[model samples]
Target: MEFRILTESSDWQGIIGEIWRFKGAPNDRNNPILPSYWQFLQIRLPELPETPIPKLATLSWFLREEQKRDWVDHRLVSIDPTLHVFSPTTEQVVFFWHGRNPSQGVIHPDFGEPGGSPWYDERPRLPRLRVEPSVVSNPSPGHLMPRPAFSPALTSAPGQVRKPKALSIILPYHNDPSHLFVPLQPFPDTRHTQTKTFQFPSRYYPLRFSQSNPNHEPILTNDTNEAWPASELEGLWLGSYGPHGTEVLYLHSPEECRINAWKVTGDVNVPRGVITWRFHSRYQTGPECIPPAAGLDSLPESCRIFKGSAHVCGTGFIPALESWIDCIVVVFDRDDIKVYWESLRHTSRYRRYKGRDISLETVPNESDSGIRVPPVWD
Candidate 1:
């Protein structure tokens, strides 16, 4: 029932307003959020609001609205964390763009109202860098840069084979607290026991855990000392790379199915280089299943179910489990995708930059139940 979006730049308030407008309600009665942009997000699927979504709350924002004017300049609402209400079995959490500018693009009517709206000409598309098609033409002299020289052993005999680049991709949540991947007998935790057979709630279920019992605190206990956290992860991103475009990517899965994660696979053309991705996943699977793999041909690889723990306690001592992989960032160059796991890594330090905020939740629908889609956002 919670959602969040992280950004390097601040403008969170304005982005909130944009999301409201996309829902067909742009201005707030007292304070308004403006001058924003949201290109990435991480949200829970079942908690998306439906036909008549109630009040929206901001759990945490980059800067307090009370202290600054146009905090949008340097301080943006970098991360937006909110718990929402929705019918679990009835609605699907969709991630789409929101805006009032025709120059920007379009807006969805059902985003807020199905037909009741001063609808824009078109709905806005998710923000993203477009990838150029691979040109088959001959490379110019300067463009045809030489590949880095390989060790002589690689070119030794006529029958010798070139080795594939060994990419030691680690999707770590926190800087590696490297414990030898040992078999632990379910770290004496009760949450795992209570959630052992808990079925994912259907969309029609109106009452939320927080709503039903405000007294219920997310599992909090001290193994060595004391603790605290929230349900959604903040500062989330993805990372991956392959020798040629990415041939494979392995990331940790979510501990629970409560939140719906996202990943976009395409061509990301930066001034420095190009990142092309052939596949992306928004998969929900168990720890026992083999980790899912994406095929190079665009077909999503089946989520590999496996048994393990990648759970971290968030703001309220809430156990944030990787029920699903949230967002995957893929960078592409000639034939390789430079995927950075920054999204997956949990760093204590904060990075600063200038930009707008984006606060769109993943609205889940019944039709999308158990279905996996690529290009989740843009």
Candidate 2:
């Protein structure tokens, strides 16, 4: 993940956001992502100290906690090109802050263990940001203004849109590392550093996370009340893409009887944002069934199967070189989603995306996953 500069002022403060690059797979799409500020912080951290850090915006900040999270996830997981697997991460971001010196016994222990110590034994700890209510803010000219790379995801809840604004949120500062500052900018300004030093893994600092929109509905199209069993698969899934890597795919059953496989992440051959393959429930009829490819087992005996057409394209995805190929699909629980392309004589496997990196809330009425709760970080 990288933050690209969108605009600038006298210093590193200006419009900025993160971008995810595109990687291709076997079944590719036409959308080649160049630069995308996919989201803007509904609530932002107080800026870290200003510096020459290109991707790392330098500014001072104060942390706060919000009883409610109006935030969303904006993260990307890079699958190993050969291993065909994604690295798993915990929902928490941990780092060290404040001084590491041992505690003193001057103050009352009622406040904390070693109330006398200015810093809590100073070790790595999990940080949470909570935006307090009653904290309205005005945009500051000295700080970086955030702009969405694309349009920011702004719905605090499904069907209810929330507007982005400068918030004077406070991160409660305890006697130790916690800090609560008003006006929403980093405390103790450091933009005037004369040394001009540039280094990383700084003495001790922090890590970050961007939660997916807890409220945005992600159902492709739910026209019917009782969706097909495939509707249970209506979330993020990863499809195998040969040696290039494992590309991200989203399976949504629309029109009640058909399943459409759309590329959430793809490589150059099939970039992303287009349907790779889809099948109608009506076509899986008749007694004769085709055998599986890619050395996969033939019988789950009771799983649903479908015959479909897989979309294909050349290396660069030239419009004229695009065509559809015969393919078969398999749905064997959440762990095994498979697709076999007869033209390539290969079968691609899919599974529930392990990357909790990013995702919007599943559509409420369109899905049956139960009430989705945002991770409790703040």
Candidate 3:
């Protein structure tokens, strides 16, 4: 067994002396002197006289002589210091301390006696001490377990034709048609048509179509009061009325709107299926433009642009309108747009400032247009 001695002090002689005082009376038969202590004394104190004297008797004589000469305090010498020993191999711990027994004025059962002064060996041989060796081995191949085989029927077969998954459409405000309608500037020729050309309050503007049908005219039908003909309805389009320089437009349909559609063909590099749009005031300014002053409270009243995209999915016919609609539309308001923009800006700015070892305790106020200033931490 491997033994380690952990001690708070390096005064070995003081420790030994402390152990000797409580090592029991001189006539006790069951003396607690341990084999380890005998080995320690043999190696550490070979200069002691070889005269035969009982271990307890020698210790008593030395202690008395020191006390009489006032060389050491008898009271201090009687202290029983504890020794902690640990055997790693055996996983055993032994705490040895010399003290008087409660039942009889003798050494405690757990303490070991100091080795006697006149140590003698009656037997020719002492028991040999050896540490048992630990064994380590790798698991055998026979013990290895194999993974269970999966069923081939559960996997797709070669040359199998997989059906396209239906895209899920989340309607804004429970599929309210009023929310889906987007207004746009009238066509150029309609500028003087005398049919309320500039602002058709009752008509819903159609910004895009699935197919390029020039024959399809923008006829304001009294029955539906729509700006465009029903036959031309084919894809999806997002439109917002902003100042000339800040207009944002997104159009997607079966044919003409394909350019704006995010194509998902199982490739990771390409954005697929569902797409979302949210208005962020910060990015409204062009790249070359500087951020406006923070004191500005609100956006320009003239720029009352409705900015946001409606989610659309699948192709189906609306029984109520008796028209075929290719996509479902979901719209969001200015409040939703503002919230999204603020959250994104806060997160991005936090990461950037943190990387530069700067504190973002107080964020700068947004400008009049509600556009947050880009953070630049030194």
True lDDT of residue 323, candidate 1: 28
Candidate 1 root-mean-square deviation in Å:
25.8
Q: Given candidate 3, what's the lDDT at residue 355?
A: 13
lDDT (tens digit, per residue) of candidate 1 on 46-67: 3446767664533322222213
Best by TM-score: 2
lDDT of every predicted structure (CA atoms) = 0.21, 0.39, 0.20
Clash totals for all models, in order? 77, 37, 4
User: Model 2: which ten-residue window has the lowest total lDDT?
Assistant: 76-85
Angstrom error at residue 228, model 1: 4.2
As for TM-score, the candidate ahead, 2 or 3, is 2
Candidate 3 weakest ten by summed lDDT: 346-355
Whole-model lDDT, candidate 1? 0.21
Q: Using lDDT as the measure, what is the rank order of every candidate, best first?
A: 2, 1, 3
Candidate 2 lDDT tens digits, 162-266: 212111221221122211121111222222111134100011111112123345443222232323455556666656677655565667666566878776555
